[model samples]
Target: MAKHLIVGGAGFIGGNLARELVGRGSKPRIFTRASSSLVNLVDILGSLDIVYGDFLDDVALRRAVKGIDTVFHLISTTFPGTQMESSVYDIFSNLLPTIRLVEICLASGVKKIVYASSGGTIYGEPKTIPITEEHPLRPKSAYGQSKLTIENYLNFYARSTELDINVLRISNPFGFGQKLLGTQGIIAVAMGCAYYNRVLKIYGQGETVRDYLYISDVVDALIRASERSGSSIVNISSGFGHSVMEVVEAVEKISGKMIQKEFVPARHGDVKVNILSNKLAKEIYDWTTKVDFQEGLRMTWEYLINKRT
Candidate 1:
């Protein structure tokens, strides 16, 4: 019960996390799907102990948690927009595995579990400018609903069992390892479309605002949560808001080229504005973003540009 395991350590956040931990002289174990690509982990792949398995496979899940203390659960098989495609995919794929994971962790004598929750979709429409952790839990989309459900389960397990848990309601994170053309991750998608000379689509005149945090800061928070002594729920965010139009302008400024835009009607279940308050995270964990917005954008832009070469 003294080892660290990253359940979904193949993706953008997870890969970066593994690298950071390795740099800090910690040899972390990574649990990812057999199908997940290792592009983001190419540099640090040799430094990790990777175990491949499906989330629903009890045997595999149990094996992953065997002799491990803190589990960083970061797996999401479905995106926010595509969660509605299947009636039960979110429940079966995302939510159920979490509950089962807790059961397995308890059985294996694992100490703590740090879950990656969503800040963008969890609190649907904010009644205030900067939403706090105390805001009512009302998610508008299937993805958000699924995250909240997992949070509830974690709370129940924390209270009923000896297992410790921490839920990180992370804001929209954009950086080097994110999906370049994915449906989610506005900054990643925009950068991808811009590099490939594809038209960037704007929903509802680019009015939606979201809290965007850098990936390094996000990894820092995840590491902090793993070492945190208390079982609690906190928001990991930049505590600032950025609109779609503002993002577009920033990209244009960085790339020095105007991105071709096509404005479309707003999609369903989209939040109008979301700005998370990181005051709790600061107070609780003494965490804050060291990378500013413009610097983060510049780094992302450089990564995207170098990607084409």
Candidate 2:
């Protein structure tokens, strides 16, 4: 088994990745902040080596990367909807720390890095349906721009150094362990509202479309990316698009309860529609999403209902 270190191991995706690693008989080290919540990793506390610190700490980053064969970079300080208000902060905090991380990985002799990127926002509004890996990157939000910046840096290091990098431009992932209160993760937020009998908020006429994938499928893609050799970028998505209103209907259908909703004016960084083609992911990792949208909705609703009661 290969040893691994996760940069944002306490987060939704990172926590799931850590659990998956433990299930595979790999003991993984997770670097998280003191203020970060560990609710997502509560059950598997004994299975992981946890380190507490911020990603900007050079010494902690160096220590965490030592002796690790691969590093899973999943830290993101901003979201597409709110990044525009504090663009400079996103650049200084997220982009700079990631550059430093790449430098540390290069110096510490880490073999490879698997990056979790944004497929939902990276391509902006698609000029064509089913966006491919070769789609032009015209990101609208600062968060998307920052992710693109890191990708460019990874490409640079791959060309100049001996490091191998894999960028998985993952689509919208929602399932168990996601925060229900946050602005991100639409499905989780909808489930929260439905459970509490609150109004589910939808922006811009509820017509914005997104490609959703489950958390377990994303972890599988990450593991595949870690095992696969060579430097490349691929899209890990469902290749099926669902509108915002459609998601609400799915939740209503699954729970057998009506979901009360409200439509507000669209935000600045919001896109009209975004979907990714998994052709490259299939060719590279022989991977395709196993969970359909309806099944994923049922699973998420059940998890949310169980958690609430």
What's the distance in Å from true for residue 70, model 1?
0.7
Per-candidate Cα lDDT values, in order, are 0.89, 0.89
> Positional deviation of 69 in candidate 2, in angstroms?
0.8
The true-structure Cα RMSD of candidate 2 reads 1.1
lDDT of 1: 0.89
Predicted model with the maximum lDDT: 2
Q: What are the per-residue Cα lDDT tens digits for candidate 2 across 1-309? A: 688999999999999999999988878999999999998788889999988888889988988988888999999888878657688888788889999999898888889999999998888878888999988999988888888988998899888988999999999999988988888988888888877788888998889999999998999999999999899999999999999988888887788878788889888887888899999999999998889888888888888877768
Error of 2 at 26 (Å): 1.2
The regions of model 2 sitting more than 4 angstroms off are none
Worst lDDT window (10 residues) for model 2? 78-87
Q: If scored against the real structure, what TM-score would every candidate get?
A: 0.97, 0.97
Query: Of the candidates shown, which would achieve the greatest TM-score relative to the real structure?
Result: 2
RMSD of each: 1.3, 1.1
Question: Per-residue lDDT for 1-309 in model 1, tens only?
Answer: 258899999988888888999999888899998998998788787889899999999999988899898999999887666546663988898888889999999999999999999988899999986999999989888888888888999999999988889999999998988887777888888887777778988899898999899999999999898888869999999989999999989988888878889998887878899999999999988899999899999999998778767
TM-score of candidate 1 versus the correct structure, residues matched by position: 0.97
